[model samples]
Target chain A: MNSTIALFLLQDGVINGAIYALLGVTLVLIFAVTRVIFVPQGEFAAWGALTLASLESGATPGTALLLVVLGVSAAVVETIRERASMRPARLGVMAVRDVAMPIALLLIVSTIAPTKPALWLSVLLTLALVVPLGPLVYRLAFQPIADATVLTLFIAAIGVHFAMIGLGLIFFGAEGFRNEPFIAGVFPLGPLMFKGQSLVILAATAALLAALWFFFEHSMLGKALRATAINRLGARLVGIPTRATGRIAFALAAAIGALSGTLIGSLTTISYDSGFIISLKGFVAAIAAGLASYPVTVVAAIGVGVLESFAAFFASAYKEVIVFSLIIPLLIWRSLVTAHHDEEEE
Target chain B: MRQSIRIALLSGGVCLVGTTTLAQVNVGITVSQTGPAAALGIPQKNSVAQLPKEIAGQKVDYVVLDDATDPTKAVANARKMIAENKIDYLIGSSATPATMALVDVAAETKTPYCAMVPSKAVVDPVDEKRKWTFKAPQNDAIMAESLAEHMAANGVKSVAFLGFTDGYGQGWLEEVEKAMPAKGIKITAVERFQRTDTSVTGQVLKILASSPDAVLIAASGTVAVMPQKTIKEQGYNKPIYQTHGVGTMDFVRVGGKDVDGTVFPAGPVVVADLLPDSHPSKKVGLEYIKAYEANNKTPFAVFGAHLADCMSIAANSVKPALEKGKPGTAEFRSGLRDAIETTKELPATHGVYNYSPTDHAGLDNRSRVLIKIVNGKWTLLP
Candidate 1:
């Protein structure tokens, strides 16, 4: 292509790549700390985007009800798990944290979101409501199987993905929603015209990346999470709470998903089931990173996005094929390089 | 009381005359009520449910099944309806692929099927495999001609084509090319994408680079909104056109301001209120709108109206066949097929259908009306 066409393709690819990078980082985070692939990461984005759309339309989103259900179930599972040695004070605290807090948040969102708060504020509220779901899902579906084989954990993650997709359908219906862009205007940079939403996506990705860096570099909890990621058994023996670390990692992943969703909400139409495709692309990027190395995963995701953009310009019908074909070679390289190890029986 | 007595006497006389006479006309319908096409298929189901309960003094037993928009399931559903339910006629399948599969089942079983999809492949070529098949929706060829004419009239010299990479999209592309060349309109870009694709930015940018006078998107349902929104966001200020596949409330609701001024061709049901009173389809279209709104609590979708037209066609045949023989017999099925094949100037919803042995979808220009989306509402274009 000529210089101007190449420039536009680059712009489109970078904007899409930024979102994929956010998702790739989230996938890597969940896989590193927890042995699960976190297949439902895309659902968080769908829920986030759909919730924002509902709030914008001055309607109370069904995510409020989903939060309430997930919260109650999480609390119930926790209670049953700890019932044999339960302290009354700890039980009460757990109930307040798991059940009462989500219900209160749901009530607050229902009241404020319908009054049509500022778009940014509503988006923040949607993130708050959706981010907790990641940890709640972990407690309900994954924590009990924490000691299981990686294969079993992967199967459980797939089950969670299906359940979330069904729940998403129930909440959002089959109709698709498109959110209003957070920013409106276009800027010409050199030979390319840059969309305002594209800038928002870049800004959000950078901000979240910096925040994650600070959290991992300075904070005590962040250090604990790092320890858990490095060696779960060793960290547990040394007094790091592995369960809490899993929750923190899942929560961060969910936050990243919600942020990514909000950033891209206005750029495309989102339905209840749009998450799987978006997450699959991110998964490809994560695999390229070997499910580790946050910076590399981000760069790989942007590469996938730009490649897809150019592919679409050249062969639009085979663009998906071109993007997905990257995985075959990557998989081959990984199989050739990484050493295989069988899991030991506990 | 008089109507009830007349019906009772008529049934009593028929029963006294012969037990082998036609008892009921069973119609088996398969629609995509739960998948990607549910927005269109659900309304088709609702309209089929509203079919007249009795045809030709015989009770009509209708069984509706959800194919989930899958071609395999659609074939399975058709087989079940034919073998187990012993249906006399089959009406089915909102999406094109499912209808194509169901048509195969109908042909194999020697049972007549009325397909609700718009692809000309359903009834074209007039081979033995398609002898028992009929379609209710206007063919893609007719709609494409209308689009080409509308674009040409609006001074569009060149156009870009972006459509779904499926039967629906390919059908529109073929038909639009056939008509555009005749209208002296050059097609600048031809792009395709899947229905579930997350973005069409690359295709939209390419279309912009080509700088066509207009763009015609040949996608259906909610998926159509993506490219339209992308084109608008990218600041392509020119005429934009869509196909009849997008005549749904969800398209309007999802597209919002981005779809404003999008020109396309649609069936009369979408703008039933806008048709002049002297128009042949105005009254029938309004009647369908009333029945649909009463049941669905929304305006009638063109797919639903197509099914309504099919029901009318089926009803016209069943009344004549019941006078001849029983519904489940081969003779009765043949009679029904013949009746549907001979459909002539039958004024129902969508348009006045005129079917012949050579032309199964015998709709002319009367079946299509040029429409534009103005302020999130369908408006007729003179």
Candidate 2:
């Protein structure tokens, strides 16, 4: 209740909120492009953290095998679907992107990981291993039924979440891992001493946010993605490949998730099953933002984190209930205040 | 010549069947081998593997089942072991809930059950129903008294309590509450957290603000690491105490440098080498340590030693039954149950257990030893 204690709690809340913000943004992005709620976003973070742990221990992470399996299967499905009409050059290019690239990356990672590379290099390798599975999952599970109703896509996303959890258990085992901090030291700020990892988390979140802004604002591919997000059918009519846009959106979400995972894993001991709660918290923040507006989602995530901190201080035992219950009021207010509309006419 | 050879073969087969029925004893075990408690349960399984195969003159056959840390599965496993396997003795279940649930099966089936968890609820206030049950580990009540005595001896006047939100936490809180107030030590604050929680910053902040003389974290396993690391990172420097739940190497490895100076109570297996040569549990504890370390890839954990202690108790009782009657008979099992309840001064790895008809848990203050993490190794407190 004192000023010093309040300041410490505030700092703690902000660091946690920053991670939630990245997840919030990813949830909104996937929902916008694919009309899927993206329930398995937290699995990417678990995979990323566990993969780094395995790499540090000089063991070949099972995530590498998972990436190859998902990539090859996605490629096979795509090849079978396009076999009759696609020319040889296009098929070769597709094969290179979908199957060969993952295999090559797997070989490189398998060789480098055993040498126990620098922390930064290991993190990059982990991201590279985990990020591609996003698009591959989309292609295998969602792309074939791209025009399905939102409810159907939501159910599929849940199934994907469960499958990822099972795969995570196989890869990481039941044991939890706490990775070494990316930045190790304590910074003294007046009366409050900040952990180096906390500062790293805040800075990384800000940098990623800025990078996302630039990508969406300046690049042609960014604008095409935005166009697809706005109106998939219209964007397709205007020569934008919506399926490609969906793939790009999923890929970006995966990268964001893995980065957050690497940051959060250093701060806490994470198990194979820890992602579901974190994913639920991110979902809460996204719901607060009505699954739109990146800035609003970030702000709402910070609010969610701060509220949880205060609630833990007050009730302690009921902190989860306190944080989760906030959603009811936010939903009520959004429904009553904002204009509700159905999806745009087909 | 062919008819004479067939008659001899038939006579040899009959003698073989009779010898098998009299020589083999079945000991059934159920532990949480594949769930959140797997880290603890797997060690129990390892210890069972290291148990002396031939106790006394009878060959022991252990039937191991995985409860997956669920109470329902634990009960079902107990039923199967009692009914289908017709086990003469049972040892189980690393977690408290599962152990407590299995107690009913033990009572109903009239089979001697040895529980591995620390909660006194497994055996305290003994009655007719609990006559068939016994526990090997030092109970929370006994350990709490040792911790409280340690605090009082050090001139500590106030303490803060932090524990898991489930049965383990509640049990520690109750015992600490009973022990501390009796010694004129005031509890300044109490806090609880879930095992799966990723952060305890808010709880840590409040504990720091209260500024008690010491903090006692009552959580078990790797989950206790969160609060310990957070309190250290937040710069709360005072005596920190943990329950025996944090005695494993995984807890130390996860907490790392943060656990360097923390003090706690643990079974003698944790500090067997550091104890005085005359300590009662030292020799048996050292024997268990060697046997466990030889078989397990990880460092010797107290859970395995605790399970070993339970198996020792079961074996001791089975020896008497084997001498009195044949194996796999109802009379032998009933006699085993009666013999276990009368165990006296039986030295094991954790402690010398003395079981009676009225009290089943058999362990006392002697089972607990005060241990501190000095320079990352468990050092025995003088």
How well does candidate 2 match the true structure in TM-score terms?
0.87
Name the runs in model 1 displaced over 4 angstroms: A73-103, A343-346, B1-22, B233-235, B328-331
Q: Please write out the lDDT profile of model 2 over residues B1-382, one tens digit for every residue.
A: 4996476446435434644566677788899877667767877888877887897777777778788789999998888766656677889898888998888888888887889887787887788777778888887888999989999999899999998888889989999999999989999989888776767888988887788999999988766777888888877888999999888777777778888888899888788888788888999999988888788766777888878888888788877776667777778878888888888998888988999887888987778898898877778886
lDDT of 2 by residue, A1-346 (tens): 8898788778888888888899988998888888889999998888888888888877778888888888778777888897798788977886898779888988998899889989989998988888898888899899988888888899999999878876787677666778889889898999998888999999999999999999989999889988888888899999999999889998998899888888988788777777777777888899888887888899999888888888778878888888899999999998998898777335
lDDT (0 to 1) per candidate: 0.85, 0.84
Note the residue pairs that clash in candidate 2.
none
lDDT (C-alpha) at residue A151 in model 2: 84
Clash count of each predicted structure: 0, 0
Question: Among these predicted structures, which one has the highest lDDT?
Answer: 1
Please give, for residues A197-237, the per-residue lDDT of candidate 1 as tens digits: 88988998899999998998999998898888888899999
How much is B39 displaced in model 1, in angstroms?
2.5
